[model samples]
Target: MADKAAAQEFDILILGGGSGGYAAALRSVELGFSVGLIEKGKLGGTCLHNGCIPTKALLHSAEIAENAKTASKYGINATFDSIDMTAVNSYKDNIIAGKFRGLQGLIKSKGITVIEGEGKLTSEKTIEVNGETYTGKNIILATGSYSRSLPGLEIGGKVITSDQALKMDTVPKSAVILGGGVIGVEFASVWNSFGVDVTIVEGLPSLVPNEDAAIIKQLERAYKKRGIKFSTGIFFDNVQQNDDGVVVTLADGKKFEADLLLVAVGRGPVTANLGYEEAGLTMDRGFVITNERLHTGVGNVYAVGDIVPGLQLAHRGFQQGIFVAEEIAGLKPVVVDDANIPKVTYCEPEIASVGLTEAKAKDKLGAENVEIQEYNLAGNGKTSILGSSGLIKMVREKDGPIVGVHMIGARIGEQIGEAQLIVNWEAYPEDIASLIHAHPTQNEALGEAAMALAGKPLHG
Candidate 1:
């Protein structure tokens, strides 16, 4: 245990050194404020150490395996012999290590005090760690989240969460993943590419249910083509694990047995026992309730990241962190609407969208006022060359600005930056249609969609 000091003070104190916390620290330091970043584990927290970096690394490895497996289609003489789990794990670990080192270097260079320990809020403006008190003029809560499981489902033996899945030494012969959200589908994609018999059980009507219905349809088709099995709109009734393996029973009495069961229901805020309620922070179902500006209704206190409850994305956390820092610095940053935040699921044939879904757009803007145009990747030169098929759908008001951009295709996540800007800035289709996109690129698909939406069809 470290010594109990009188107290250390800072201009800003951020809890949980994940994407959100770290981003806030960096921005606060740049604003010439003393920052204290506290974390129990690694500096990069879950996203870099366990969540985003590692998972994306696995997804990339899966993509490589898929590419090699289908190299014959590209007229290449190549064979994907087998996935070396050890080598794959090594590759993933290396990427995480490199990023972790870079993050630490950045924090050190910014002169932010990196406090190493678990911190609990002792008051609205103070945190206590290792029996030492630290006070800040302003305190930002960015505790992040953890994987959650269903009731009566014990996580042990062969049943695991993503945190355990990332550390597995051997790939299972078969897996039954519960919950077909972003995490479930991603792991299903990876395991399928690695030669595992994977099945996804989602209680929703479709996989990636939060996405646009059209995008979900395309993703289902792609997954079906890949022979990845999934059961949707059905809840599992029971799960039993024996020494040999695990068996999951659906509500319809259908049974699925696999070497392991992955519970990917979603993540819950890590707000329990953190003294949030004691500090008078308003919370709903464990998530800190904040105003549009992210205020916690307490003096000099604010919350960001997964704990704030909009999108659980690390990038969302990053943006919220910066927003909170700027707000504290009296920058009066414009509040970013959650709907406008870009979301990318890094599954095979990735899904990326910004702003409203078509249904959402119609509901909000009225069906009579909404217009949509979907451009198929089958018509795009680059997608055909890459042996991929997808669609870029644009939703806009009948004669107004584009409200949403939905896409499904290989490497489509890379196009989210422009889509986010377009939606957030309320750019009209004509405004984007006039801009030239590079020839023979997947991104040009967006331009094509915009052109068609703006009353001119180009290679549609």
Candidate 2:
């Protein structure tokens, strides 16, 4: 397809081509809307070009190295050695570029117009890109987010954000990670596997603070066994860069030095310079506020993804994007239940959760009504065979229904599909317990946990 000149019109004009933007564009086009997607950056947005894709590529390299070293225990004798950062980075880049190309092709196949430039919402129905105005019946914002930093700390050579850390050409000898959320734990696992001295400083009481307490404890023990250190319930006092590296000062009057400092606190929405406020939209902090229907304050304007509040996962953006597209197509789509959405942290011994945590369940359903059961991975044959460590936790009301399930273990994120089904359907423990799980598979852990909650457990 050849590039078209300035003048054009679209049925739906989308600003920001990240996960949410692309999702909305494709869905809108499928709904018979002439779509135009305005992207200032790459087609795949931060996820494909930076955040999720590249980080996973780097983490996979760590997983491979660690697996090779432990191959003998899995019935194969193999010796793992050094890591070539050059080769690793090349591999990561190639993967990212390939996926981006695939995404571009998909967008083109959908017959959606792609405008390469910064997009500004001139109004609810008008968007300006590359100095050209494109009018549409409806508008969607899906700019996503960027890594954030604390007050005193800033990004430099030695001090960096996830964006910079993902592209490092050389591995640091030692590193200090300032957060213990999903990003921090994932990076800590990656660096620790690469033979770096890793220390995680978390303001919360435990790592993966949003997860179940049992899961957090399991992860803490596993990370500690792998030589990763943690300083929880503490704060960062100051960080000063020197010739060797950066000196991280804690609020407790202790100092730690590292070759690199990764600030993995969180991400801030990418709504600035997008003309959201000028378009008469309501925003909190940097996030765009939207109703359950994903409608913005501006008439005929909507927002999704990191720009909209709640979970910042890409899949969540995809759902919201599709929902708004269908809603605009006059399908009268059902509202999304935020609590039904599943969340996963892609670290080794990955954490996956859906619905309420134990504390939240108690608060919502009352302590006497809520019940929880846990199945240790140690009792599962599959986990024992793979030498994986973690547990499966289930929360339900007394004879009511299963409301939540949380898991932690190697490749356990994959199991959330089953957990989500049970939770979303509000299935009772008896319902899941009646079904048979394949023997010696990781999914059997879910069945076991459910069975235990049903008052009888075959394993653990």
For all predictions, the C-alpha RMSD in Å is 1.8, 2.0
The alpha-carbon lDDT assigned to residue 349 of candidate 1 equals 91
Q: Best by lDDT, which number?
A: 1
In candidate 2, stretches whose alpha carbon ends up further than 4 angstroms from where it belongs are 1-7
* lDDT, candidates in the order shown: 0.92, 0.89
lDDT for 275 in candidate 1 is: 92
Collision count for each candidate, in order: 0, 0
Top model by TM-score, which number?
Answer: 1
Each prediction's TM-score against the native? 0.98, 0.97
Q: How close is candidate 2 to the true structure, as a TM-score?
A: 0.97
lDDT score at residue 71, model 1, on the 0-100 scale: 95
- For residues 186-284, write the lDDT of model 2, one tens digit per residue: 999999889999999998889989888888989999998999999999888889999999999999988889998999999989888888899889989
lDDT of 2 at 226: 92
lDDT of 1 by residue, 1-460 (tens): 2333323788999999999999999999999999999999998778998899999999999999989999999899999999888999999999999998999999999999999999999998899999888989999999999999999998999999999999887989999999899999999999999999999999888999999999999999999999999999989898998887999999999999999999999999999999999999998999999999999999999999999978898988899999999999999998957888899999989999999899999999899999999998999898888788998999998899999999999899999989999999999999999999999889888888999999999875
Tell me how candidate 2 scores on lDDT: 0.89
The alpha-carbon lDDT assigned to residue 384 of candidate 2 equals: 86
Model 2 deviation from native, Cα RMSD in Å = 2.0
